[model samples]
Every structure is written in C-alpha cells, then in structure tokens.
Target: MLADTKKVGGFLLLAAALLLNGCKEEKAEVGAAAPALAAYDLQGNPASLEKWQGKHVYLNFWASNCGGCLVEMPVLEKLSKEFGDSIVVVGINTDKEEMNIQALLDERQVSFPNVRDQLAITQERYQVIGTPTAFLIDPQGKLTGQYIGMLHEPELKAIFEKSRQKG
Candidate 1:
C-alpha cells in the first residue's frame, strides 16, 4: 500500500511540473536581457546586437517568402534612417536562399543592415515562431517589447513611445 501511495505521489508531482511548464509562453521574456546575435551581414560583414549596446535596437526577424515581412522592410528601413543615432535597426533574414533575399533587398532598394539566419539559430534563440516578429530592445539590451505580425510606422512609433513612457 505504501509503495502504491509513493507512486501516486510521484505521479502527482510530475503532473504539477508539467502544468507549470505548460503555462509558460513560448516567446522571449520581456524585460529580460536580449540575446546577443552574432552573425554575418549580407555583405559578409560581421554584425551583432552587441555592437549596438548604446542605442535602442529594433531587431526584426523576417523571411523572403512572407508578404507581410516584405511590406515592413521598407518601413523599417525608412524609420531606421529617420531615427538615426538614437536607434539602430537590424534585420535577421531567415530565408535559406540568399538569392531570394538579395533579390528582394535589391528590388526594394533597402540599405538597412541585415544578416541571414541560415541555420535558424537566431530564430530559436529569440523564440521566433513566425516571420515579421520584432523585438524592441533598449539601449542596455533589455527586451522592451515583442510584436508579432506586420508592423507599420505608426504602431512602431507607439511602441517606442510606450517604452519611453515606461522606462
């Protein structure tokens, strides 16, 4: 009888642990220090979030095939230029084919720096489940906000405003 009671107790503990783990969201925790992204840019130059330590970093994850991702690239590019010195924008392209990515970049005339995540390491590190995911990181590298789906200029500005208001 005691053996059976111990077995039941262990089973209950396992069940409780699973429930707790299940409640956790499958995304980067806001306010946590952002993960360092060490990779090479499309031009074969080294790039990483660690390089932008003193400025707010707009880190966006995108893919060549996603229409929404394509829509937001130009917006990000324009805003990145306008924000200048205050905020730095970086894009992580998840497409396996460099040709497609470069074609899109060329067609769009996007000059903002972007790195390719061919191994999906960047995606996994950031808990990115979809294209067009963006993390607004503070100057100190803390993840201020995570936004999924397409983001326009106004919404991006609002996110910036909110972060400033809270910080």
Candidate 2:
C-alpha cells in the first residue's frame, strides 16, 4: 500500500511539471531573430515586418483605449520622421474596429505606418504584456530591446545608440 502511494505521488509531480512547462509563454529575446508580423493596415493594405528588412524598426503595440498608447503615438511619429529612411516606426493597433483606429490616428495626425491586430495574434507573437509595449529590431532583423509602458524620445535614442554599438 505504501509503494502504491509513493508511485501515485511521483506521477502527480510529473504531471504538474508537464502542465507548468506547457503553460510557459515564449517571448522573443534580444539578439534573436524577430518574429514575423503579418497583418493589414487600417486601409486594408498588406503590412508586414518583413517589408522594412534593411532598416532599424521601432515596432510598437498599442490600443486606442490605452492612455499611454495614445500619448506615445505622436512620439512614435516624431521618431519615424526624425529617423527618415534609417529607422521605420510601425504601430500595431490591437483594436477590434477599423473606424476607431482610424479616428484616433486622424485625431493624432499620425503619419507613420500602422497595422491592425484585431485578434491580437501579432501581440501574442511578440508576447506583449501591455498596451504600450514596444520592440526594437536592428537593421539585421534581430531584436534589441523590449519596452513595456510609455516610451519617450530620450529613452529610445539611448536604446538606439546602445543597439548600434552592439551591432
């Protein structure tokens, strides 16, 4: 009877370990190849991370209802414009409706490229934990950093500088 009890306990432990391992979420790591993002823009045009393969990419995940996301739109736009052809800023809006995404972009006067992630598939691809999450991919298509919450110019500039040094 004691042997049977020990066998059952061992089985339970093994089962628990398997469950925990399966539940673990995979996240893109710095210095690893960035995961491919395939989605459409608000205009229904195809947009993808692979489109800008040769330039540094500032990929930001956002939502219309998130205040921090709203605040950083203009900042991201500024970065896209400031960097010109060197760095491309791509915003992935995790909102259900196209009209809502458009309205916010129009209101913000955001001219940078933005794609729609209505189902959040792309969000899960990057393992985004929050609305204002962002990933920086170097020109070689390797992830350099991941930022959660709001982002500012100085922080981004510093990150870019660091990435360049490492690259």
Candidate 3:
C-alpha cells in the first residue's frame, strides 16, 4: 500500500510540472527579433509584421468574448491614432467566427488594423495564454516588453515613450 501511494505521489508531481511549464508566461527577450507573423485581417487583407518595419509596433492578442480585451480596444485605438506615424497598433483577434469579430469591431469603433487569427496560429507563435496580451516591438523588430492583461493609457504611453527615446 505504501509503495502504491509513493507511486501516485510521483506521478502527480510530474504532471504538475508539465502543466505549469505549459502555462508559463511568454517572454520575448528585449534584443531578440520578434516572432514571424502572417495572417489576414477581418477584411481579408493580407498583412505581416514586416510590413510595419521601421516603426514601433503594439502586437495585441485578443478575443471577442474577453471583457478585458474589449476594454483594451479603445485604449489601443487611442494609441494607434495618436502615434499613427511613429507606431503601429495591430490587433490580432482569436475569434472563431469572422462575422462575430467584425460585429464587435464595428460596435467598438476600433479603427486599428485587426488581424484575424481563428486558427490560433499567431497566438501559439507568440505564446499567448490569455486575452489582451501585448508585445512592444522596436523599429528594428526586436521585442522590448510583453504585457499580459488590460493595460491602461499611461502604461501604454510609457511603452511608446521608451521606444521613442531609444530611437
């Protein structure tokens, strides 16, 4: 009986380790080039991260059902317009239904270029575990920081400001 108990305990420990590792936070080193991303927007427009080269980019991963994601939209929109020339804010929506994604965009009045990632390909590449995951990439396409969850205006401003200072 004791042997069986020890065996179960070891199995549980190993399972926990694997589960934790799988859900580990995504980290893109500051000096490493951003991961490759290629997908179509809701309008069926092909877009890639390289297209926004030479500019700071806010790569945001979101889902229509995520309330925090909905809250982050306007904040990102404001940043997108305010820093139009200096930065590019790209929203990658992980909604399975393209039509539903469009309706949410229309209702939210979000103007930034939003990529459709129904297959979760981009999310997997970015190692996103939840909604409102944002990465700050510099002009050279190197990642500067990764933010998970809703980000306020000031936080967003600081990221942009830092990138500008570096440039």
Candidate 4:
C-alpha cells in the first residue's frame, strides 16, 4: 500500500513540474529598446539605424551560410528596388566571417544596407531563434511586425505600405 502511495505521489509531482514548466513566460530584458545595429556598407562606411529614421525599415537577420537566406536575398533585392525611397531594407549578417558575407553580397549584387553581427547582441535582444527573421519598424521607431523565414516581395511591399500609412 505504501509503495502504491509513493508511486501516486511521484506521478503528482511530475505532473506539477510539467505544469510549472508550461507556465513559464519569455521575459524581455530591462531597458531593451530597438536593437542598435552598426554594420558597415559594401564600401566600408558605417551603416547605423539612426540614419533610417522617418522611414519604414525592414531589418533582416540572416547569414551567408543559411540556405534560406540565399533564396531570400533576390526577393529582398527586388523589394528594395521597388520601395527604394519609401522603405529601407537592411540585412544583418549572422555569420561570424565578414569575408563570406561580402562575397555573398557581391555575387548577389545586393545594394541595400548590409551589416555584420559582431557581438550577436541584436540577436539576443530580439530573441531571434531562427534565420531570416525580419523586423518591420515603423517610422516612429516602434516594432510594427515580425516575419520569420524567407519573405516574398509582395508580402514585404504590403508591410511597407501599411507602415507608410501608419507613419
């Protein structure tokens, strides 16, 4: 009888542990504001987010090694051309090597803002769990929307239009 009681008690404890774990919430870091991105342009000029204010910004987190990012680069390039002045599409490199990123960009002919994640601070602050994560920030500097994985040109255009309206 004691052994059966102990078994039941252990089962209850396991269920309680599972329930507590399920209740855990993602905690945003204190004073966590918009990620500060200071990556360089193709010409080695400093590209900062401050320069992108008063316009819709599409910040894309990707790496040269990511297969999905390779496929999305062209679509992003097309979108950048279409919404040239209305929106800014900035690509953040998640790879550790700068040369690899530069090579990919050169091969793809990507002319948008290309920055490298030197410290991975932005990734951690944004809680980015996957490659090809895109954050849509309004002109007012508020996070308006987030997209994960490869994005289509039309979808990006739609988001840019929406941000313009809000601006």
What is the C-alpha lDDT profile of model 2 across 1-167, one tens digit per residue?
99999999999999987865444444578889887764688778877777888888889888888998887777778777767557778888887864477777888999988898775657777888788999989888899888998877798777655655654
Winner by lDDT: 3
lDDT of 2 at 75: 72
Per-prediction TM-score to the true structure, in the order listed:
0.75, 0.76, 0.78, 0.72
lDDT of each: 0.79, 0.79, 0.81, 0.74
lDDT of 1 by residue, 1-167 (tens): 99999999999999987864554333467889887664578777767777777778888998878899988888888887777657777889988744567777888988877898776656777888999999989988898888999988899877655655544
Off by over 4 Å in 4: 1-33, 38-47
Give the clashing residue pairs of candidate 1, or none: none
Candidate 1 global lDDT: 0.79
**After superposition, which runs of candidate 2 have C-alpha atoms over 4 Å from their true positions?**
1-27, 161-167
Task: Name model 1 segments beyond 4 Å from true.
Answer: 1-27, 98-100, 161-167
- lDDT tens digits by residue: candidate 3, 33-74: 887764687768776888899999989998878898988788
> lDDT by residue for model 4 over 44-76, one digit each (tens)?
676667898888888899987688888888888
Tell how far residue 38 is off in model 2, in angstroms. Answer: 3.3
- Model 3 misses residue 13 by how many Å? 32
